[model samples]
Target: MLLLKFFGANVDWTSSIHPSAKIEYPWNLKIGPLSSLGEKSWIYAMAPITIGEKTCIGKEAYLITGSHNISSNNFELITRPINIGDCCWLTTGVTILPGVEIGNYSVIAANSTVTKSVDSWSVMGGNPAKFIKKREIKNA
Candidate 1:
């Protein structure tokens, strides 16, 4: 079981978590059981990021839960929470922006940037992360 020693969050490792994973400034980062974060992944949760159970975060992925609103008069910084559902697979170099919620069992391709919510069982990719296709998986 992997334990995150820093930040104000608590992780229950009855689930599976890699020992070499890193979460910077995790004030309120919560990860469920049976989830695994690959090597060299960066979770920068300036706000809040909740990852569901059995989820697999690929190697070298970046989860940036901080942003700024350019339309504001003072160019104010805006922050939102990120929620990743269960059994999802995020490939390498995937970037999850603030306020994005990826549904359960979804697959995100490598080098994709998620700027919005993705439906369940959907396969997404590209710069803004459009829907590539939908996948139906049978229970094991």
Candidate 2:
């Protein structure tokens, strides 16, 4: 999709993104080699969203990198980067909040909401997602 790159997303030529995916502030987005953003996935990136090589973001997943200050009376906006390392998979309907780093080979299960950083090879699922187990890849 040369057209997609024109919109300011720094995606590798090998990467595949669905046409319906919404990437906000595309200049702040980067998807590495062979990574794919599935249909209707939304990346509301006011800051950077760096997706490492071979990552897969499943359908309807949301990666939000901006929020407003609740503690401040003025309610100023705040932005933070989201870093997803290589070979990670964020499954359908998963929501990753701002400032979260998902380590390499991690798997976020369907409908999970991640509020914190995930360790490498972790398998997490649930609201405010916690580590359920380690991801095991049996080279098939």
Candidate 3:
């Protein structure tokens, strides 16, 4: 994305970003090498969102980095970073809330909502995205 590059988003040319995907505040978005963003995916990067190398985000998935301050009377903004480490796969319709980190080589199932940090090499699923199992990688 030439526009993103111009605005200081560290997106590599090797990565694929769907034209329909919406990126807010591109300056805070960093997509590492070989990452692919699916159609209609949204990243609200009021704070930084770093997506590491070789990762894939599915269609309509949401990565949110901003929230309303619960303690504030006026509902002020609270921002936090989201980190998706290398070689991860986020299935379709997944929603990652603020301050969530998906560790390296993790896989998140379809339509899951991630509310907390996921461990490295994990396979997680369900509404609150429980850790299902550790990922097994074969060296062949």
lDDT of each: 0.84, 0.95, 0.97
- Which residue pairs collide, candidate 1? none
Candidate 3 RMSD to the real structure: 1.0
The parts of candidate 3 lying over 4 Å away from their true place are: none
User: Per-residue lDDT tens digits of candidate 3, residues 34-104?
Assistant: 99999999999999999999999999999999999889899999999999999999999999999999999
Residue 130, candidate 1: C-alpha displacement in angstroms: 1.0
User: Candidates' TM-scores?
Assistant: 0.87, 0.96, 0.96
Cα lDDT tens digits for candidate 2, 1-140: 68768988899999999999988899899999999999999999899999999999999999999999999999999999999999999999999999999999999999999999999999999998999999898987
Pairing residues by index, what is the TM-score of model 3?
A: 0.96
Clashes of each: 0, 0, 0
lDDT digits (tens) for residues 1-28 of candidate 1: 3336354665556555556667877667
TM-score of 1: 0.87
> How are the candidates ranked when ordered by lDDT, highest leading?
3, 2, 1
lDDT value, candidate 3, whole model:
0.97
Deviation in angstroms for 113 in model 1?
A: 0.5
